[model samples]
Target: MTTPVEVRYFAAAAEAAGRGAEQVLLPAGTTVGGLLDLLAERHGPALRDVAARCALLVDGVLHRDRDAPVGAPTRVDVLPPFAGG
Candidate 1:
């Protein structure tokens, strides 16, 4: 079964995705790693490139464990690299 996950993009990732947020469909219990691969495929090269350097937050916490299953009804926040001084 597939579930919907809300992906929120910020900064360059939003620019790449051409939107701040979107919904993605994934098999139940899919990992963050798997989600990234699927997302890269859906959005094409721009987002694919951003995925490499971006940080992923699932539900409000930084998700470093790509192996962990994505808990559905989830909000995934994507923050890409930024520079300011």
Candidate 2:
């Protein structure tokens, strides 16, 4: 089954994606890693590079495990590294 997810991009991530937010349809039980791959495919290498240095938040909570499953109707935030304190 396919599910809908909201992806919010921040900083360089937003620039790479060319938008601050978008909705995507993904297979049910797709992992965080899978989502990253899909995003890269859709947005190209710029986004892939930015995403590599980004921190992901799933449903408002930080998600570090790429293997973790991303459920339906979820919100994912991609935050790029910040230089200043």
Candidate 3:
């Protein structure tokens, strides 16, 4: 099995996902966009819609590049836009 990426969901994202976190296994050298795609596939349309409005933070750094690599044994936090923010 491939190394698991720690995925964390917050607020609306968490509610849509129906969970706070999960271990997602992806092959070596997967990117943020790839991860999002996989998450949308595994988590369903609710999550997919939530994901589009979410910001991704890898480890502690903001990642906007979907093609950017997601290192193994890492943490990816899913944060959606706040109501007023």
TM-score of each: 0.84, 0.89, 0.87
| Number of the candidate with higher lDDT, 2 or 3 | 2
Better of 1 and 2 by lDDT: 2
Compose the digit string of candidate 2's lDDT tens values, residues 1-84: 887888999999999999999999989888878888899999999999988877788888777678888776478898888887
lDDT of 1: 0.81
Best by TM-score: 2
The digit string of per-residue lDDT tens for model 3 on 7-85 reads: 9999988998899999988888788888888888988999999888777888888877778887774788988898895
What stretches of model 3 exceed 4 Å from their correct place? none
lDDT of all predictions: 0.81, 0.86, 0.85
lDDT tens digits by residue: candidate 1, 1-85: 8877788999988888888899887788788788877888878899889887777888887776668777774689887777951
Best by lDDT: 2
Q: How far out, in Å, is residue 25 in model 2? A: 0.7
Model 3 TM-score on a 0 to 1 scale? 0.87
Candidate 2: which stretches are off by over 4 Å? Answer: none
